[model samples]
Target: MIEIRRSDERGHANHGWLDSYHSFSFADYYDPEHMHFGPLRVINEDRIAGGQGFGTHGHRDMEIVTYVLDGALAHRDSMGNGSTIRHGDVQRMSAGTGVMHSEFNASEHEPVHLLQIWVLPQRAGDQPGYEEKRFDDADKRGRLRIVASPDGRDGSVTIHSDASIYAALIDGAEQAALPLQAGRRAYVHVARGALTVNGEALAAGDAAMIVDAAAVTLEQGRDAEVLVFDLGALNG
Candidate 1:
């Protein structure tokens, strides 16, 4: 079965310099029915105005991943990791034990757009860590590239979670597919443009939760960039 979450149905918040849309319950946007899926916790599409950003904050036992779609995001953390993440960059930060970090738009005149994702870790009290990689358009064009995984296989960033994240860039008639394992589920998130996932149309900010799906397909895209997550069953 496939369940669709329309872009307009998400929770929204605007704070002068920051505009954000939450795919699940976040901050002040609480939805009991849309809390989370499996081990997937948060998906926040954020746009930060020039010279603005999130102040230093703390997190624990969360596998945090950030994907920049436009502009750049400057990041600094308590673990002494500092970097500028731009388009095509995937960053993973393990907030095990505990950690404090801050993120800011690296431009003074241009706003930065990005998706911040959080997944529950497979184990608690692990050491804090960070990793980042650039997945060029050529690597994702007409295909899904594994960008994050439990063991960092295929050069993906390690997340210490029973999940793998795939990134894709599709245009026109381009297509791609990922075979799902038994008992696993899938989550497709459209970052920009439009895409048809297994015959269901998804626009920017839209998402689909797929259960008992043997395979997930992407086709008939219109300049689309999407992220697909293969996740293990939720723990009770």
Candidate 2:
């Protein structure tokens, strides 16, 4: 089964300092039927106001991944890690035991736009860690590039989960496909611009939840940047 979730259907919240859209139930946005997909818990598309950002917050037992789209995000964590992540940068933080972290727009005049992703780890209470990597736009222009995986394979960031996340940037005549093994599932998220996923049109912030499928295909894109998650079944 393949299901499409439109951008307009997502839950939205707007504060003076931040505007966000939640793909699943998060904080005050609760939807019983849209709680989660397998171990994928949260996908929050956020735009932070200039000079304002998330204050130090605590998290535990979750694998968090941050993907920036516009501007730069300054990150500081309890693990003594500090950096500025810009476009095409992927940052992964394992809040295994517990961790406190904060993110702000590095620029004083421009807002930062990004996606905050959460995936459940295979087991709980492991050691906390951090990893970040940059993928050139050329690498993902016409094909899927492995950005995060279970073992950090192919230079991807390591996440303690039975899942693999791939990213792609596509334009006219550029296409890509990811084969899926039986019983596995896939989720395609269009981060920005418009694209065609498995022959279906998708706009920015749209997503496709696919199950019992052989593969996920991308084609006929118009300046599109997308992320595809190859997920293991729940509790597998």
Candidate 3:
């Protein structure tokens, strides 16, 4: 089955310096019907203005992944991990026991656009860890690039959960396909441009949830970037 999360249906928050869209129930946006999906807890599309950012905050027992689409994000955490993430960069932080961190735009003029994802960890209090990698356009063009997985396969960042995240940059009639395991589900998020998933078109900020699906397909309609999540069981 396939369900669409229309861009307009997402929760919107515009604070002058920060404009964000929440795919699922988050912060002050509460929609019981759109609370979450499987083990995928949150998907927030954020655009921070120049010289602005999220203040220091805390999280625990969640697989937090950050995907930068434009500009640069400076990250600092209680674990002493600090870095500047930019376009083509992916960062994963497992807030097992607990972790405090902050992310701010590293640019003085350009806004930082990114997707912040949270996946429920399989085990609690496992241990906190962090990893980041750069996956360029050439790597994702016409294909679904596995940017994060449980084992860090193919050099992708490792997450302590039964989930995998794939990214694709499609254009010029190019396409990609991802085989779905039986009993598993997938979530496709369109970051920019337009594309068709299994023949259904998706625009920027739109998302499609697939469960009991045989496979996920991406066919280019125009230049676009997409993110796919293969997730396991959900809380019952």
Per-residue lDDT tens digits of candidate 3, residues 50-97? Answer: 999989999999999999999999999999999999989999999999
The residue pairs found clashing in candidate 1 are none
Candidate 2 lDDT tens digits, 78-170:
999999999999999999999999999998889999999999999999999999999989979999999999999999999999889999999
In model 3, what lDDT does residue 218 have? 95
lDDT of 1 by residue, 115-221 (tens): 99999998999999999999999999999999999989898999999899999999998999999999999999999999899999999999999998899999999
Instruction: State the C-alpha lDDT per candidate.
Output: 0.96, 0.95, 0.93
RMSD each, Å: 0.7, 0.9, 0.9
Sorted by lDDT (best first), the order is 1, 2, 3
Question: For this target, which candidate reaches the highest lDDT against the unseen true structure?
Answer: 1
Q: What is the number of backbone collisions in each predicted candidate, taken in the order shown?
A: 0, 0, 0
